[model samples]
Target: MTNDMKLNKLLLTLSVGALSFIQACRSPESDEKLKSTIQAALETTPGIEVNVEEGNVTLDGQIGSDSLKQNIEDKTKMAGGENIKSIHNNIVVNLPEPEDAREKYHEIIGGAVDSTLTRDVNLVLADFPTITAQVKEGIIVATGNLEKSKIDTLKKRLEHIKPKGIDMKGVISR
Candidate 1:
């Protein structure tokens, strides 16, 4: 081939190569596509929040279980593919609240203890109509006029009901 023709062909090839390389470089559009893909993948998952910027994906908010977290991460990777630069998982695993003794008593003892406690409390406070009693935090709090003898009797009866203790601070006539 002629020297001038060869030179022109080489220049054209180099120009095309440079243009392709520039086009292949990361852009805002690519990042947006990755974000869209991740959002679409996690659309059904509740409480999971996602943020994407410059091909970096950030996952945040709460999840119920560790298995769920793993599943979500795997799905995110599948959706994001090689275009994802990095993944920042800041998701928190939330546990359920523990059951309290009072709640268990209510569930198990139910009307049996409730009725007996009411009857016994009424018997103890029959003379003092102004006095009121309630069960709070596993303790029986009696308010208004009270006597030590009545308190002892109430405590003896309440032992059957399995209370933690009797709160006598509300009783004025101790």
Candidate 2:
């Protein structure tokens, strides 16, 4: 080949390699696009603030009921799809005060919901032998060593219960 032809061929090969390297290094999902998807899911629900980073999402706002809060979270998760890594549902449920708030609280303590939560939490823990969790008063405290790959899946399953909060601070991930 002529010198000019060899130079052109080398440039084309370098260009192809560069493109391949970039494509291989790119993440499956972009944070901005994922945020838009989640935002669309929560658009009908007011007072919601959605933030996404590296596929992790945080939903913060005020809503009327526990069920609504869970519903909003579910919608956003579905819309976020397989790209989601983790989610924090910080939306608060503003339930109207009962005639006697203390009495209402007592009545619900150890109620069927709590029983179910206890049972469900145990079941979840069983699935993750390396991790242990405790449920009390609508909150979950988890502690143990977990594989890094399982973190998102475990978090999603735990969030499905719509707990007041989850404290995984004691858990270590590899």
Candidate 3:
């Protein structure tokens, strides 16, 4: 083959190789951008983790309620766009009470216990009616117009439906 023909063939091969490299590079950059967007959207949600692999996104986390989980999934779908072939949501709803119930007593009780406002033993004791209907994973210190019978009853109920780890103290009904 002539030297000029051989030179032309070499240049063509190099051009094709470079084009392939650029295309390959573009894919990963796009995937990274998608991953970043997904992470940003999920930042406010607690107990959730986001990961992207080969253009597929997976969301794993614990949501406070079932409705919140659905909201997260819908938002994720909107963010994925055309490049995202599939999404796997493994979100867990940590609602303590049954769905059909008018009120989630456990969640309400847990929230109150977890709140800084109810951390005071005196405040919790004075608010018996407000707190009695709730269930929490914490120590209960009773004080004030609470009767021993009432206190014992509350303690028994708490023990019966004890949440993972909780301790009761000074549960004396006044």
Candidate 4:
């Protein structure tokens, strides 16, 4: 091939290679920024734990109340930028359940929901309750109706049991 033709091909290949490199390099900085923002949000909210994997931020741990959980998410979104792939709100608020404490808290919460009192609260616990109670990796799921005043009372009552985890999916009174 002519030298000029060879030179042109080499430049084109180099340009493509450089473009690919730049695109690949972009995500790490974005990921780091996301991580820092999530970390800050977690720090602001008591009992919130955040883990970032492949640009997805998973929040785990118990906040005192559901309002706190929502607030954490809002703040994280504001700080982390719109590029964040997912924000897993796996946070659980502590609550009571009946069963072996070692078993998953979700099971216990499930049992509680099945009990007579659950209907009175006007709440339906989903098959896999959205409320997950976790502490140091252990987990329990609690889902039911919750009046604002009753939530504090329920939390206090559950604290006495002290299971490995608690998930309180208490719906606010309509």
**How much lDDT does each candidate structure score?**
0.67, 0.74, 0.57, 0.56
Candidate 1 lDDT tens digits, 10-110: 99999999998875667878877888898888876666888887778899987544555666787899999988878998889663222232343344334
Q: What's the TM for model 4?
A: 0.39
Better of 2 and 3 by lDDT: 2
Query: Which wins on lDDT, candidate 1 or candidate 3?
Result: 1
- Span of 10 residues, lowest total lDDT, candidate 4: 119-128
**Which candidate gets the maximum lDDT versus the true structure?**
2
lDDT of 4 by residue, 1-174 (tens): 999999999999999999987754546667777787778756645566776665687888874434445767887888777667678989896542433322333332333322223331223223223332333333334555555666666565454444444566543542
In candidate 2, stretches whose alpha carbon ends up further than 4 angstroms from where it belongs are: 1-29, 96-174
lDDT of 3 at 173: 41
> What are the candidates' C-alpha RMSDs?
16.0, 16.7, 11.8, 12.9
- Global lDDT for candidate 3? 0.57
Clashing pairs in 4: 105-140, 105-141, 106-140, 106-141, 133-166, 133-167, 142-167, 142-169
Model 4, residue 140: what's the lDDT?
36
Give the top-scoring candidate (TM-score). Answer: 1
Q: What is the lDDT of candidate 2?
A: 0.74
**Model 1: clashing residue pairs?**
none
lDDT of 3 at 34: 87
- For 4-66, candidate 2 gives per-residue lDDT tens digits of 999999999999999988654535458788888888877777779988776778999976557
**True lDDT of residue 31, candidate 1:** 78
RMSD of 1: 16.0
